[model samples]
Target: MKIGKVLIANRGEIALRIHRACQEMGIRTVAVHSTADAAAMHVRLADESVCIGPPPARESYLNVAAILSAAAITGADAIHPGYGFLSENANFAEMVEAHGFVFIGPRPEHIRMMGDKIAAKDAMRRLGVPLVPGSLGALASLEEARQVAAEVMYPVLIKAAAGGGGRGMKVAQDESGLEEAWRVARTEAKAAFGDDAVYLEKYLDRPRHIELQVLADTHGHVVHFGERDCSLQRRHQKLVEEAGSPVLDAAQRDALGAQVTRALKQLGYRNAGTLEFLWQDGQFAFIEMNTRLQVEHPVTEMVCGIDLVKEQLRVAAGERLGYGQSEIRFQGHAIECRITAENPDTFLPSPGRVTTYHAPGGLGVRVDSALYSGYAVPPHYDSLIAKLVVHGGTRAEAIARLRRSLAEMVVDGIETTLPLHLAIMEDPEFQAGDYTIHWLEQFVARRNPAR
Candidate 1:
């Protein structure tokens, strides 16, 4: 049951990433793109290409029907949903499999269970995985939310039942805050995910966002590739990610990975996914689980020397994993910086033609991007322009390399957050790995001196 060909059901760097992995495996690739992405790097890199629909995500990347049709026409045996778009859609996965194409991800049921925040937290609790104390189920009403907050104690978090990317989340410190927060959170959730249900959890003050990467197969085998510290973020959007988190000890790392594996086993998960948590006060609590591959997966690949995309394809082809936990080794350190097309100061999108683009390269430097010097960055999609990844024998060396790479990197014509990234590397707290989720807010406040 070897997968000879794969239909990449997304665009941008992730699509190109999967194409490269497929090429190494000798598996032909078919890229499905929108009208705007006809000349995208992913399209040019794939062995074959098909136009799905218009530029909007809903009509193109998220259109399950068109993707299935493309796969059928291209004679692809499997589909890779990269990271975003239809990656987490359980229905899309089911449709792909139903159309006689393997979906390179976990079982649809597993995706459904983990995609919903409330169900995911409950699953973690049932597996004896430590979770942030909160309501065990979705809130029935605002009164129920308040009661749960009262039971969990004040300064709790209100989150969308089916949410991510920091959308539909609010912090309430008092009864007054709970009602207003709930109303606003529900609205945001509906607008973002079309889900109005909200849940409650105790807020971990000054928490570090840490996540474990786990790869499992249809067989009853699961193993972790260590953890990534993604605490440096803006509005819950990960800006930088690094493997071998400086905050965790060997024992803590083992415990965290074990907890994630046990929880996924209980839920009967397969394929590659991540367990996200908030680490605070020397303890970790399950926040949510991503049923799809993450954007920051390259850092894990660099440190572990395992091509996650290849493993994903192999697992989807009904093959047992080639290695065991003992064979898995994490050596050295790796860091990834996301280069977004945005105003450094205002943080607003700045999409336009790329007048100049030069990705830094040398020892311990890798750039994953879809942009070239003359590529016109469309205004319809995300602002992410590139991902700069660096690896070194130690965290300090990795930081130094990243600093040097960032200094050498050049992108002209449009504004970028590179300047802000440069500033962060110079910050003492960030350099020391002492920054938390609140660090960015505080940094902006200090820099602007006014809101």
Candidate 2:
């Protein structure tokens, strides 16, 4: 079951991150990329590289046939689909396994189960995970939606069953708005995901976005790496994340962790996964589960001192988790700032040459990026160019370190979110960790009233 070589089916920082982990584990890496990313850092550092297609992602990164062909050409024993792209694709996972390469993720059935939001919620409910009160499944009609909204009370959320990144989601302030919200949500869902199926959930007014990171092995051993507070987001896309949330004490962490691990074990889940929740009034309601590594996984690693990517590799190779939940411990606090190639104020994509690149360096600072001097930031992929991670003895210390690191870090010749992150670090509310899922949007509006 030893994985000698792995094919990285991704790009940018995450692809480089997986390559580094494979290198550390004495596994050779095959980096697959589009023609536009032939010069990417991961492609350059890999033992072998393959060009799958043109600049557009549809022709390249998501091209399953080309990626599988590359893996075959490179003799890869496994395929590691990093956080995005084909990571949560159940069909791709099945194809990878069908092609005789280990897919370093959850089983296809698990991915398929969680890919559908309604099915995932039902499964979690059966496994003792708390869910927000709403419709039992996709609403069959506007009347059904109205009934569910009334049952859950007004101010409900209409969400796409196959949606993420805030797409296909609308808020109905009251019964008067439910019809339009439902129509808009379904339309958006169909246009975006090719599926118009939408559901309802009781909207918690001031819930914090907290997620539990869990790793399960094929041997039935599961462990949790605590929780991350990702409430600092704009439009449902997280900008900053903190490990071991400020409001959650050790007791709270243990209780949630125990519940998550137990539930995942009962479901027979394997590999890396994250269970997202809305925490309000000292209670957690399961929202959804991401069946892949998260973008902010480094923060969890910093606090738990576990190499999640390596664990994924091991589990995919049919190895058992050597330790149990009790053995896993949370250490110092960690924070991660997702630095994207976008305007700080307008938040528009800024893809161009990176004339100068310098990442922060210190005892507890880590930069996961693929950017370099003279590199062209591709316009075809995700705007995220780098992730700045910092660890410290406490949340206060982590903020201080993050501020210092942000000052030292530099990405020139293109607009980046560095300024925005610096502003966040300086804000008192952010420093105090007195924020919720709606905090960032309000903060941004306050900063720029014109927008």
Candidate 3:
């Protein structure tokens, strides 16, 4: 069940990352692209290229039929849906399997179960994972919502059953505000996810985002990489990420990792995935599970010294887990900064031609980017231009190395978040690791009063 030729069903740096992994494994790769991405870095490096559709993502990246057609024509035996696009779509995964191609991800049923927040919670609970105090299931009506809120106490978070990225989430302080919160959350959920099903949960005042990276194989073996601290984010979008959270003790980290991997192993899960948790008061609460490779996977890979993308390919080919949990080792602390094409002050997308794109070079520094000197940063896609990752023997050394690497990085002709990252690297609170998810927005407000 070896995968011979692989088709990449994504664009940009992730595709290039997967391409390099396949190259290293001596496997052929087929790059699928839209008209706008024909000149993308991944397209240039692939063994073969296929144009799926026009510029828009719906007609290109998300068009399952066209992607399958491209894979079929290219004779690719497997498809790697890199991070976004159709990566977590259960229908797309089933379609790929239906077309006789191995989907380089978890099973379709696993994807579907985790897609809904309610079902995912139940699954996690059954596996002995601690969850945030919330509704037993999705609320059906305003009355149900009220009942759950009463039982769970006040200051409950209304969340979309099928939502992520803070889109369909609201916090209600008391019963008086529950009705409006429910309505608003439902509307947002419908508009954003096409699913108006909402749930109730207890809201934590201050919580840090910690996620455990897990990998499984068809042979029933599972392994967990140490967690990543993604507390630095805006509107639920992660910016800077680091391995070895400053707050968690060694015992706590190992316990949480063991809990997550054991859960996945019990559920018959396979492939790469992430179990996100809210860390508060020395307790870990389950948030949600991401059934795809993460953008911050580089940080985990840097510290663990395992190529996650290659492991996905190998697992999809029905191979056994190459390395056991004891064989895996964490060498150093790693940090990653997502450098985006945006205004440093306003945080708005600034897409245009990259006049000068010079990546930094030094020890413990790695840059994953699709940008070139003349490559035009497309407005229709994510504004992330590159990811700067650094590793060191200690967290302090990692931070200092990341600062040096960020200082050396150069991207001209388009405004970028480079200035913002630079300021963060020098900030006292950030250096002290005393920030949470809400810290970035507050920092920006303080830096730019009257904005």
* Residue lDDT tens for model 2, 129-176: 999999989989999999999888989999999998899999999999
Query: For candidate 3, lDDT tens digit of each residue in 212-315?
Result: 99999998999998889999998889999998787887789789878888889899998999999998888899989999999999999999988999899999
**TM-score, model 1 to reference:** 0.98
Candidate 3: segments with Cα more than 4 A from true spot: none
Q: Measured by TM-score, how close is model 3 to the native structure?
A: 0.98
On TM-score, the stronger of 2 and 3 is 2
Candidate 1 vs candidate 2, TM-score winner: 2
Taking all chains together, the TM-score of candidate 2 against the true structure is 0.99
For residue 368, what is the lDDT in candidate 2? 95
Best by TM-score: 2
Better of 1 and 3 by TM-score: 3
Measured by lDDT, the strongest candidate is 2
- Please tell me which model should have the higher lDDT, number 2 or number 3: 2
Global lDDT for candidate 1?
Answer: 0.90
Candidate models: Cα lDDT each: 0.90, 0.95, 0.92
